[model samples]
Target chain A: AQSVTQLDSQVPVFEEAPVELRCNYSSSVSVYLFWYVQYPNQGLQLLLKYLSGSTLVKGINGFEAEFNKSQTSFHLRKPSVHISDTAEYFCAVSPRGSNYKLTFGKGTLLTVNP
Target chain B: NAGVTQTPKFRILKIGQSMTLQCAQDMNHNYMYWYRQDPGMGLKLIYYSVGAGITDKGEVPNGYNVSRSTTEDFPLRLELAAPSQTSVYFCASSYSLDPDREDTDTQYFGPGTRLTVL
Candidate 1:
């Protein structure tokens, strides 16, 4: 079994400022991590994912995340934020192999204020 | 390709009513899933299908049913709808994971269906 925990429920940041969304997971076996973004009134979109190798992974919309096994965290970061970057972000995890059940965190609303 | 499509973008059903949420994908993916997202909460899987003629339950399968008769369509049925079922429903599809490849398995989603049970 696996579960995801997103540290923040809401994150407010000014335009052009850096931002980070923290996510952690717990599982007995190796797991795959993913970050998804949801715009208003839309479905979730894949921003990035970490399967193996390269603890640091980059994703669409100029976003990136680092996977820290020891800390059991996959934190998403953006160097600079744009007003368009404001959206709900979700962190999800699924077990290795053919398992397709993804456990997701509650979510974090990233409000980029201009 | 249409990617993923869900009908009835919005709906309002009275308690104990029944309805079906339609989801279709043109990507020819082998895996399809149903998930519901409550306000401020993450999405929870309701049901999933590995392929045509095979279905399975997920984290939150109660009060929901699904069927996969074709590769392109997987519909979710809500029996005796309740207020608790009022949420945004999303249908997603993804290619099966490959053990040999380290690339992360990604799921593509539909626009979503917003349901309100009054």
Candidate 2:
């Protein structure tokens, strides 16, 4: 079984400030990592994913994540956040050699304050 | 394409009531899923179907039932609704199961239906 842990329950940042949301995972085998963003009262939208290849992956709305294999982490980063970036972010992991059944972290609410 | 679509944007149910959450996809996706999101918690899979006539329980499937009568439709049924079942439900679909097909596994989600049981 796989599980995800988001280090922070909430992150408040000022507009134009850089931000990072930490995520860690535990799994017996290799896994695929994903970041999803959910706006208020809406379903989740895929922000980015790390299946293979480069450790640094860029996503929509100027969001990016670095997959650290040694640390078992996939932390999301944005150089400059905006008010529109306020949302809940979730990290998910799926088994390496199976159907895509995701195990998600609790989530971290990103509040971009002016 | 309309992608994945779920009906009933919001609903309220009394204890012991029953209801079905309808889901349909126009993307010809073979894999459909039902997930519920609670406050502060991420989505938990309730049920899933790999194709028509094939349904399976997910991580949190208790008090829930599902049917995949057609490739385009997958409905989730709630029997004897409880307050614990009140949450936002989302329907998602993916094209295939191949791990190498990561692009295809990127699920498309619906608008979601918020249910409150009192």
Candidate 3:
């Protein structure tokens, strides 16, 4: 079985400040990592993904994540955040051999205040 | 392209009532999935279909049923509405078997349907 864990449930930060949302996963087999964002009253949208490449992965909206295999972690980072970035973020994992069945972690609410 | 669309964006049902949530995708995707989003908790897969005739259960399948009768449609049936089943539902589709984009199996999501059971 595969599972995802997001350490922080809520993160409050100021606009233009750096932020990091931590995520960890446990899987017996090789897996793919993904980050998704959900704004108020909207469905989730993919932020970034790590499918087997360079450890560092860049995503839209000036966000990035580093997939650390040894640490079993994929943490999403942003150099600076805006008020519009206030949303709930999620981390998910899918095993390589499966048909893209994703296991998602409890979301982290990122509140970027001005 | 209206990649994925769900009908009855909002609904309120009485306990023990039954209803079906309709989902359709215009991207010609081979794979489709249903999920429920609860507060604090992330989305949980309810069911998934690999093609028109194949469907499988996921993390949470109880109190729900799904059918895939065509390439463009997949509907989820709730036999008995319960408060526990009240949540935002999402439908997603992806071209999972496409070999060209093997590394990036991105799933496109529908706008979502909010169901309330009272």
Candidate 4:
């Protein structure tokens, strides 16, 4: 079994400042990690995913996340925040192979202020 | 392509009512899933279909049913709606993850159905 935990429920940051969204997971086996963003009244969009290989992965909207196996964390970071970047971010995990169970965290509401 | 589409963008059902939320995808994916999102509750998996004619329960499958007759459609049925069931529902689809084939576990979501049960 696998589960996800997003550290923050809400994070407020100013535009042009850096921001980070922390996520951690618990599983007895290897799993895939993903970050999704949802705008107001919209569907969740894939921000990025960590299948394998690189520990540091980059996604759209100038977002990046690093997979730290030791800490069991996949934290999302943006170099410079934008007002448009304000949205709900979700961290998810699913076991390897054909297992289709994708567990998601409670989500973090990132509010970017001007 | 219309990755995933869910009909009846918004709906309100009374207690003991029944309804069906339609979901369709054009990606020809072998996997389809239903999820419900509540305020500050993230998302709870309702049901999932591995392929046509194969369906299974997820974390929260109570009060709901699903069938996958075709590769493009997977509709969710609410037998007896309750106020506890009021939430936004989202349908997602993804390609099959084969051991030999490339890994594609990314799930594409629909616009979601805002369900309100009184």
Q: Point to the candidate with the largest TM-score.
A: 4
Report, to 2 decimal places, the DockQ of model 1.
0.71
Off by over 4 Å in 2: A97-99, B97-102
DockQ agreement of candidate 4 with the native complex: 0.72
Error at B34, model 2, angstroms: 0.8
- Give lDDT tens digits, candidate 4, residues B14-44: 9999999999999878999999999898999
Give the interface RMSD of each candidate. 1.5, 1.8, 1.5, 1.4
Residue A101, candidate 3: Cα error in Å is: 2.0
DockQ, computed on Cα atoms, for candidate 2: 0.65
Per-residue lDDT for B18-73 in model 3, tens only? Answer: 99999999888888999999998899999999899999998899999999999999
Instruction: For all candidates, state DockQ relative to the true structure.
Output: 0.71, 0.65, 0.67, 0.72
Comparing 2 with 3 on lDDT, the higher-scoring candidate is 3
Query: Which 10 consecutive residues of model 1 chain A have the lowest summed lDDT?
Result: A94-103
lDDT of each residue in A12-108, candidate 1, tens digit only: 9999999999999999989888999999999998899887789999999999999998999999999999999999999999886544678899999
Q: Which is the better candidate, 1 or 4, if ranked by TM-score?
A: 4
Backbone clashes in model 2, listed as residue pairs: none
Give the poorly placed runs of model 4, Cα more than 4 Å off. B98-103
TM-score of 1: 0.95
Candidate 4 overall lDDT versus native = 0.93
- Kindly give the stretch of ten consecutive residues in candidate 3 chain B with the minimal lDDT sum: B96-105
lDDT of 3 at A37: 95
Model 1 stretches astray by more than 4 angstroms: B97-104
* Candidate ordering by TM-score (highest first): 4, 3, 2, 1
